[model samples]
Target: MMKQLKTLLIAATLLFSTSQVIAQAKIAHVDTNEIMSKMPAMMEAQKQLDNLQKTYDKEFKTMVDEYQSKLEKYNREAETVTEQLNTERAKEVQDMEKRIQDYRQTAQKELNQKEEDLMKPLMDRAKAAIEKVGKAKGYQYVINSTGLLLADGPDLTTDVKKELGF
Candidate 1:
């Protein structure tokens, strides 16, 4: 009987302590997308990306127009020129087309790289602010609410935004 009593006592103590720990674990959620969208630094970074994209688009359009003009000229002259000259012009057009494609691919890669360079710092700053706010609020876990279907915990978005200073 004494052994059974001691076993029950130990089980009760363990259960109580586990409950206490669970109750003390504070969780919070934040809408990171909302925070990032409102961030001034992010807005500036977006503007820079947009401008770069526009520049790339304009340059690409010019190249496309030039390629089309040359293709048309070669097609029209194909009958008048000798077979060798026509073949050479066709090869030149093919080379120009390849160059245009290569330029487009290079531009896309450069734009992606530029976006990463510009946005990485802003994203890091936002993440730090969120961490700071979460720690300050005694949150053990801070989940991003973007993908959450249900977030009944306290919201840390406002606090995080404030920490980031708009």
Candidate 2:
């Protein structure tokens, strides 16, 4: 009975030690916001997005100006024109307003799509760099510091930025 008790105690001690070693996970944190802000590719992507938005804004302004001028001309001619001509002008103005609305909607959709297309690759690159750094550095868990209330782990944002080559 004494020998049996010694064997059981030894087995329990071995199990506890193994479990303790396994529990010591290498945790790390990263601020993706910081990493992305420092990335050159992200900066270039943002510049391109801004330029695209400016182009869209210019085209939209032109359309609006044309619509306004046509409406003003129709209003001024309405007084001297025939009833049929006045009705036709009114229909034309309504059609122009509808077309403007449709164009604005389409432009918005296109801009959103363009932004998504431009951002996806940049975001994916950042994510890949973070993953690569975490694995290379033997981090079992990497948490984003952007949303963390308390982060006591070592920050890997700089490492990730380096891994991204910027």
Candidate 3:
């Protein structure tokens, strides 16, 4: 009976100690999206991406306009050209259409790559700042509040922003 009582007491003590340790753990939250949006580097990167997209748009428009002009010219000349010449012109137009599609696809891929390249460093910087703040503040766990339905812990977004000098 004494041995059973001792075992029960030890188990109860362990449970209470574990709860106390959990209660002492410090938790905080940060909105990473908020931090990234406010970052000047990210803003500049967005502007650059926009400008690149505009450039691509302008080039695509030029190509489309040229294709339309050629198509119109072919239509006008269709009645005068020989059967063989008409067939060749149609093939040329088809080839031009294919090239235009390939160019658009390539341009889209390049733009996506550029955006990823530009954002990677900024994201890394934000992560580093978050880690620094979490360690300095003695946070056992730092949760991202952006996706949380209920976040009542201390917000570390401002601290991370300050740490990044933004």
Candidate 4:
């Protein structure tokens, strides 16, 4: 009876540990955007994009304000004014408004493109770092946390974050 009991206990322990090992997963997650934000090159690019956006916004505002002032003046005096001035002033305001709209769209698109361009190297670095860390740490799989929405790989994130110094 004792021998049978010992054998059963040993078999149970071995079976539990084997199953635990089999159930273990080597999955990891990394936030590419988070990594990109910490890159010095990306920071400088973001600064440049911000400055450009501010400058363009100011310019667009000035153009719109100028047009609005002219339009308001025209409306105030339009009833008493000759048809010639009315037509010319209306045309000017329309042209100015169109220009402002175009400039705003262009400036926004340009800034977005610049931001994308600036992010490339940072993204590359992050990916490279992830690859390196994963290999060194025996990570069998690495996934971008961006797509996960939520994940239990917080340990992987913390480790990667520390390793990247981000």
Model 4, 1-166: lDDT tens per residue? 9999999999999999988875685877777767766666777887888898889888888887888888889999999989998999889888887888888889889888887887777777677778888878887788888888677864355566666676
* Model 1: pairs clashing at backbone N, Cα or C within 3 Å: none
lDDT measured at residue 21 in model 4 versus the true structure, 0 to 100: 76
RMSD of 1: 5.6
Query: Each prediction's Cα lDDT score?
Result: 0.92, 0.88, 0.95, 0.80
- TM-scores for the candidates: 0.85, 0.80, 0.83, 0.73
Q: lDDT (0-100) at residue 140 of candidate 4?
A: 77
Leading candidate by TM-score: 1
Comparing 1 with 2 on TM-score, the higher-scoring candidate is: 1
Q: Which regions in candidate 2 have their CA more than 4 angstroms from the true location?
A: 1-23
For model 1, how does the per-residue alpha-carbon lDDT over 55-101 read when each residue is reduced to its tens digit?
A: 99999999899989988988888889899998888898889889899
Clashes of 1: 0
Ranking by lDDT: 3, 1, 2, 4
Q: Judged by TM-score relative to the true structure, which candidate is superior, 3 or 4? A: 3
lDDT of 3 at 126: 96
lDDT for residue 1 in candidate 3, whole number 0-100: 100
Model 2 TM-score, all chains together? 0.80
lDDT of 3 at 86: 91
Which lDDT value does model 4 have at 45?
82
